[model samples]
Target: MSVETDSHGRLYLSSELRQKYGEKFHIVEYEDRLELVPIDEDPLQAVREAAGDAFEGESIEELRERAREQAKEDAEAGFERGKRTAEGGNE
Candidate 1:
């Protein structure tokens, strides 16, 4: 569908579109075009729905510790890879 912005640069969505999506949108710019991404009205609720069972059996502190450990491991692995690259080693 084609949409045009007004003099004030406000692109109005149709009532049907607004009802399907939400009132807010994020405009993403790419090399050839722009895309409108709908924003969730309740972002936290959206995250909860998206996560589903991923975080089901973990407490907040437990999750935080797990994330920290994973991040540390990732950083160490990246450092090892960089070190190998600097030493002219191919992986």
Candidate 2:
């Protein structure tokens, strides 16, 4: 199928396409081309499916704590990486 953008540069997908692929999409742009990735209609369900068995026996509080710790660790690692990059390190 062929698609064209309007003067406002907004491209509208056909209903047929929308039915096949969801109503929402993630537009990915590369140096050469663009791609439209369909997004999950129910993101929480997708997360649960993806996270199978990882947090099977964990309580809500335990999950929250783990999330917090992971976020902190990720932030610290990012900060360290940024610092090294700024200090002329290739890391």
User: Can you write out model 1's per-residue Cα lDDT over 11-46, one digit (the tens) per residue?
Assistant: 988999999998998999999999989999998568
Runs in model 2 lying further than 4 Å from the true structure: 57-62, 73-91
* RMSD to true structure for each model, in Å: 2.3, 4.8
Against the correct fold, how does model 2 do in TM-score? 0.61
lDDT of 1 at 47: 72
| Model 1: lDDT of residue 87 | 98
lDDT of 2 by residue, 35-66 (tens): 99999999756777899977787777998999
Range of the 10 consecutive residues with the lowest summed lDDT in candidate 2: 40-49
Error of 2 at 90 (Å): 17
TM-score per prediction, in order, is 0.76, 0.61
